[model samples]
Target: MEKRRLGRTDIDVTSVCLGTMTWGEQNTEDEAHTQLDYAMDRGINFIDAAEMYPVPGRAETQGRTETYIGNWIEARKNRDQYILATKVVGRSEMTWTRDSENLTRQTPAQIDEAVEKSLKRLKTDYIDLYQLHWPDRPINGFGFHSYEDYATDDMVAFEDILGALNRHVEKGNIRHIGLSNESSWATMKFLQVAETNGWPRMVSNQCVYSLVARRFDYERAEIAMREKVGLLAYSPLAMGMLTGKYDSGPTPKGSRKDLFPTFLGRYDLAKAAIGDCNETAKKLDLTPTQFALKFVESRQFVTSNIIGATTMDQLAENIDAHEIDWTEEMEKEAHRIHQSYRSPVA
Candidate 1:
């Protein structure tokens, strides 16, 4: 329920941001509305969504997440009550994201189309934070590690991406800008470009950060500390691996891992680390869910921890995690797990 300043922006967002990536695919429209209502009632003032959501990213259900949020906003008529954040897809082969395209890149024209569609789907005049979903450069994001050949010519340049976002800021379509799945170099370059060009500054970086994945600590943490673009950590529970429900040999039925096995690859590599997390939580007399959720939520460098759930029970447990007092023992246990894993998934 605590709020924090997002970089140098006047916007104040809650440390616990409600994530809605699963809204249309795993959950129905009513369920999405229920989650929104419950989250607001629980004092969560920040909601994060994306244009390419309800994951698995099929052409059929691509934009349903924003539609659900848009309906909720229209029904509640409290758009000003929450800090809304959404992203534009970076270089991707999923061209169905754009009606006439087979490949989507963060080019200026594509950015214009993306924002216009996102605004229409979200039913909002302005987004509090508009994010580049990923980098346009050839890089292994979404957990891929092996290097792939980069095209000699790509559709968009980094500055062009920033320039497009800046134009939106000037036009009031977006209030601020942010990035996700980006490297420390790109983060600093974006900041540098903004400073040199007198364009809008990026307010935050959204990435995967959990007890099992502490790779951010290696370098991104420094960028956050020195550059002021704090982290908006998604998958803070590592897609429910940190919750320990899957440690009894099988992933729980109806859980995220059970529903989407491929998404849990991060946990697959660091399965032992996750087990260590569960064992440590038991030693601390806490549920693995509580321990893992609190461990990420209590981090000093985390601006906000994005929590997702398909059911009310899961949402309640995630929300209650904030109430648990983070003890020294838990911190030490988190560190021990990190030491053993050394970012096995990153």
Candidate 2:
């Protein structure tokens, strides 16, 4: 696995980051541990989790994902081997994350509480890369393409959020900070604030970027290249749509689509484009999973491609995808797919 510097930080994370969003929901603690062991053996040095994880986030299963990672860290005592990253929830109604707050925001109190709880749950003194899960502004994130015309006069200032994260950095609770599900404008704003205030800068922007979803390529790619805050791309397989599992048959049992189809609704609008991408992969004599994963990995602005799985087979295949040498032919085919679809799922 190739290593890249996270932003301008000294931490060098593997190009393939192991994502742990499905651990407590579709997988057990033992399974999560096994995945961690396998990922480490495969030279994946980066692991990403969030306080509000195990998607389709229920109040009952909210922090179980971090707890599973914490248990693995405790049992293995190998915290120094990999770069650990987790997130603080942005503005949302999933109030179960905090003790008394009904709405999650990037307030100093909420950021303090969230980081303390994540450190306790992760069983670590410091996180390598702590991330803001999303902005605390009124914007339609998480696969919604159209901008919601709404007032954001009451949104928390970016300076305040960065100030809170700065305190954590100063205290050694977090080594660096990043962003997720953010826009180009927001990224610039955060960068400006951090630079002007001499605070910690964002190291990466973790967002959805797959063969079917190219929203990051439009404006953020340039920002990533110039600013050094490269992309830690999540959902590189478009929530499993780019894997060809649903191309010609019914949704497989125990799959994400079968368990919670609504979460992957963005892919529904790109069905034709996804099928075409799968066919293009076959035409190139490659599996759709390999094709999709490699395309994301090959991008110049991608610092790491976050891959997640619920089963051992899926985990093995996703990790093995790093071995595929992305050729000119594959790039041409991917370009053709992009020209046709033009970010259908964005």
Candidate 3:
């Protein structure tokens, strides 16, 4: 596995990071530990989780993902071997994550509480990268049904959020800060604020980026190159659609599509475009998984390609894709697919 510099920091993370969102819900603790051990043996040293994980987030499974990782960390006692990353939720109604409030926000108190709980759940003294799951700004959310802008005065400011994170840095609770599902303006503003305050910089942006989701490439790619805050690409497989498993058959049993069909949101809109990418992969004698995963990994602006799996076989296949040599022919085909589809999901 290739390692890349994490932003402008001295630390280096594998180009392929293990994603843990499905651990507690789709998988059990033993399975999560198995995946962790296998991933480390495969030379991957970056792991990412979130507070409200196992996605269809509910109170029952809210913190189970972190607890599973925490258990693995406790048993293995290998905290120094890998970089652990997790996120604090942005503005939302996932109030179960809070102690007293009915809403989650990026306010200093909430950030402090979030970090403290995540530390306890992860069983780690320090988090390598602590990210805001998304911004607190009132804007279009995932697979938006409408766009509405609220008053600017209604949200937590960037400096305050970074300031809260800085306190964690000072307390040796987290090493770096990052953004997710963030926009260009906020990305730059955070950097500017950090520079002004001489605070820890926003080192990366974890966002939805894949063959069918190239919105990051349009503008943020340049910011990544010049500012050194590269992307932590998520959903690189288009939620497994690019794997071609769903290309021709009924939804596989025990699969995400079969269990929680709504979680595959927005991908349904780009069915034809996804088909083009997957079909093109077949024509080139490549597994659609390889083509899709490599496409995200190959991008210059990517710090790490976060891959998730519910089973060992899927884990192996995703890890194997990292070894496939990306060819010029493949790049051209990815380009052709993008031009035809124009990032329909974004």
Among these predictions, the greatest lDDT belongs to 3
Candidates 2 and 3 compared: the better one by lDDT is 3
Candidate ranking under lDDT, highest first, comes to: 3, 2, 1
Q: What's the lDDT for residue 212 in model 3?
A: 94
What's the residue-level lDDT of 222 in candidate 2?
A: 99
Worst 10 residues of 2 by lDDT: 143-152
Model 1 CA deviation exceeding 4 Å by range: 144-155
What TM-scores do the predictions have?
0.96, 0.98, 0.98
The per-residue C-alpha lDDT of model 3 at residue 285 equals 93
Q: Give the Å shift of residue 23 in candidate 3.
A: 1.0
Tens-digit lDDT track for model 2 on 197-294? 99999989999899988989999999999999899999988889888888867789999999998888878789899999888889988899999999
Local accuracy of candidate 1 as per-residue lDDT tens digits, 1-346: 8898898888889999999999999899999999999999999999999999989888899999999999989899999899999999988898988878767888898899999999999999999999999988877777755658678476376678889899999999999999998888789989989998999988899999988778788889988877879899998888887787777776577777777888776567787887888888999999988898888878777889999999999999999988889988888888888877788777
Give the range of the ten consecutive residues with the poorest summed lDDT in model 1: 146-155
Off by over 4 Å in 3: 144-147
Candidate 2 local Cα displacement, residue 158, angstroms: 0.9
Clash tally, candidates in order: 1, 0, 0
Q: How many backbone clashes does candidate 1 have?
A: 1
Using TM-score as the measure, name the better of candidate 1 and candidate 3. Answer: 3
